[model samples]
Target: MYVAVKGGEKAIDAAHAWLAEERRGDTSVAELSIAQIREQLALAVNRVMAEGSLYDPDLAALAIKQARGDLIEAIFLIRAYRTTLPRFGATLPVETAEMACDRRISATFKDAPGGQVLGPTFDYTHRLLDFKLAAEGEAPVAPTREASQEATPHITTFLKQEGVIQTEVDQGDTPRDLTREPLELPADRALRLQSLTRGDEGFVLGMAYSTQRGYARNHAFVGELRIGTCAVEMEIPELGFAIEVGELELTECETVNQFTGSKTEPPQFTRGYGLVFGQSERKSISMALVDRALRWEELGEDNMGAPARDAEFVLYHADNIQATGFLEHIKLPHYVDFQSELELVRKLRAEAEENLASAAANTVPEAAE
Candidate 1:
């Protein structure tokens, strides 16, 4: 058993007390409610849910509160909690085609079948601070237009019809889950997408940016970006039929990238797909960019020694919890290793001084002679 040092228990208790006090800065000030975080800070909650791989908004809000608004910490908490829960069964893949879209947009065509619907985005908003929101008074609800009922078709369908883009093929194989199995090199598309979905958003964004800055540049264009609720279905073997299990909000991005045909194939466009939980468009888009870059092998493109193209490098470092744990562990006791290093440095210095003294002694005797 690992033994605690002297006063370790007392120090831990004191540290916890200090942390609690710090969490609540002033008694006079109203405590930030979980409901406020769930509703007002919905974006943060959505991100936590996305990265944590758990879709419970209330629990995510609670985790956020417990973490004192540290999003990565909240995600870690949720992920830890999620591991304890018993799994019932796996649900069938949700269909994006039947999505009840709140926001749908395409960049390839200005006037596509389903016109670009900018639902609730900060895209066109000015970055000016709204100081009025600082007051506690509630603001009036803004009226919203009725959402279109027409089923929105994917923008890539147009290219597929003309044989300009590669048609999506189903290999009919269960994707290897990174959470359950060790990550293998040269990961398949499904495994790669899974990693990117749960990857650290900032790291994925950086990798994507590198690709755009001429590191295995793929000339990617946002073919379509859709945010909506999709129904999850599960096939019950006993019943011999599928039933709707639940609905979940998803943000899906499809990037159409430039592709030159191989010897056996004709010139066509390839695609990179990203689907993340909730309204995480930035993460989804970044996932798509990285996804495309990692496809250099299948696409017959040269490995330009790009960071994004290195599947092993990207997947290994994209996990925040793992990164944080390893990074923060440096604070723990390293006395033995540190002492060894210190001794080595001292020995090197002593050896240098002794050599210098011997050299001086020899030179003085020669000069005297």
Candidate 2:
């Protein structure tokens, strides 16, 4: 018999140390600071922030560097770090009508009151790789446009005024966070949005794309996509009022979709909503489509068993951190379970051999008789 390995602890520690050394990479050349990754690798930071459900890009960048740019690892770091953050209290509901947007666009309207500002997007750029950017360099400048001080009216609100958009009454105070509490079936808008905000961007995008490909097709039109900073304030119990904690960058998308006329309803346009931690328009837009699709049952429509229509499926499978952890853990040892299965198979084979011998002996007696 072979001796079982006993160096697991030492091996694990050595592997982790080697990983840390690899992440720092050529330390003599100077370590790439977190600030550099936050500013220069903005796109990667955005991806981490989107999935981590946290607003700080600097923290996300640091997590990425620490994780050796293994994105799933970085996401896990953000999620774990965010869980420990002390929640002083809930902030006042952000007024999207006054987002102070860096980017705002509505496909439902030809010319919105604020005028569509496509700020800091790669939408129109060709997909050519620039060799000049191989070495780190400064980004080119774009002329800044003057922002309006007056509050910009929402496109959905305009539709609501004219009875075009379906009006859902406010449900008093907002719902609880799903992370802190166990997820109950039939989650409210707040919980649903929270789950989607931290969901895998690719998975969410595929689900949204599936809607277009005839699975619970909602005929969605992007009502608006806005990204900007908003003030976060928490109420102090002793002070009896909310104070500004800080500011956070957010991306909000609203979708207009078709609705059905039921026994108690009239045919009207419905809504799908998505909101995320950063200026992630693509993720927010995808999230909005998927959100609306999931509401098919609540809206009194047919449950077509679409991926997006399954709330449990979407909510459970959307987190990359959980997915990757479970996935990679399979690489770890499972010798005890394997040995049990091996023993069971050996016992079964021995029983089968005994039975065969008994049967053969009985046959020989019958032949002799």
Candidate 3:
């Protein structure tokens, strides 16, 4: 049982006041507006939205401003605010084939259908920093092309047609919300994907990297990576028909792993899928790798005793909010617990000294005899 300690309210209030003052540093300088943060620090805002499980750019920017540019703190703030929101309804499954793509690329096929579109990427850029952006400058305009009206089908579709890749069959079951329901062991693919999409980026990346280092390695090849805006539709109770609620910018990744087949079954390439909010390509790829590693059981592969394969460990530890809460709580007052441990250690030492002294005394008498 935990007891609340009194008499520190004033100190706590003072600390909060100082924090606020620190957040608004240098009053002489122009304060950053929410718009500026939302537009300029987009990637950071995307990270906050992805991890916080919230999608409001304005609110994310506000959280970033309030948290003094701390992404994790912004995510925490967003998540705390999300609890007060009313749930209207769940959206239907998004169709990525209909996505208005900004960037699309495939590593498996060089001349894949729909062709490659490298949109607003840092992949081809040199590592050198541009000093011109150090001072005030006008926003640079980018070159544009005529928007294509063609639908960009997934590369996996072609592979599936050739019967080279494993086919995915929807069970038609309502996916369990990890936020609402307790995460049970032996989680389904849907639950695992939900957890991973909102999971800590660094943690997921590390787990994925472990797989590449031969810990439950699946020899993954990026079949397709696409970033685009997809329409989110929801069924309105009053209307009785599904309507577009909003559009969400998403990054989708499909990885083709080594052929896994048994004597009874023919060899077919397995697949690992990842879908995340915003242009989080790295996170999406990492998620796919980790997802594939966890699917060893379903794929009928041997357990390699990898951390990535341990579903419970990955899911539980992947949540930064929960991990940080437990970690930061250790900084709180534990005087009673510490005192108990201190007393026990002192008693043990005293008893050991007494026993040593008694043994010495008995040995001295025996030596004299």
Per-residue lDDT over 1-369 for candidate 1, one digit per residue giving the tens place of the 0 to 100 score: 234367878999999999899888899999999898999998899989988989999999999998989999999999999889987788888878778888999888899777888898999989998777888567878677775666778888888888899877898788887766777877888988988898899999999999999988768999999999888999999999999988898999999988877755568888888999889999999999999999888767789899999999999999898899999999988777877898899999999999999998888444665
Question: Residues 18-102, candidate 3, lDDT per residue (tens digit)?
Answer: 9999999999999999999999998888889999999999999999999999888899999999989999779999999988888
* lDDT of model 3, residue 21: 95
Report the alpha-carbon TM-score of model 3 versus the true structure. Answer: 0.94
Task: Kindly report which residue pairs in candidate 3 clash with one another.
Answer: none
Model 2 TM-score on a 0 to 1 scale: 0.89
Question: How does each model score on lDDT?
Answer: 0.88, 0.83, 0.90
TM-score of each: 0.94, 0.89, 0.94
In candidate 3, position 294 carries an lDDT of: 88
Ten contiguous residues minimizing lDDT sum, candidate 2: 144-153
Clashes of 3: 0
Over 4 Å off, model 3 = 1-6, 263-265, 364-369
- What is residue 263's positional error in candidate 1, in angstroms? 3.6
**Best-to-worst ranking by TM-score:** 1, 3, 2
Error of 2 at 1 (Å): 6.2
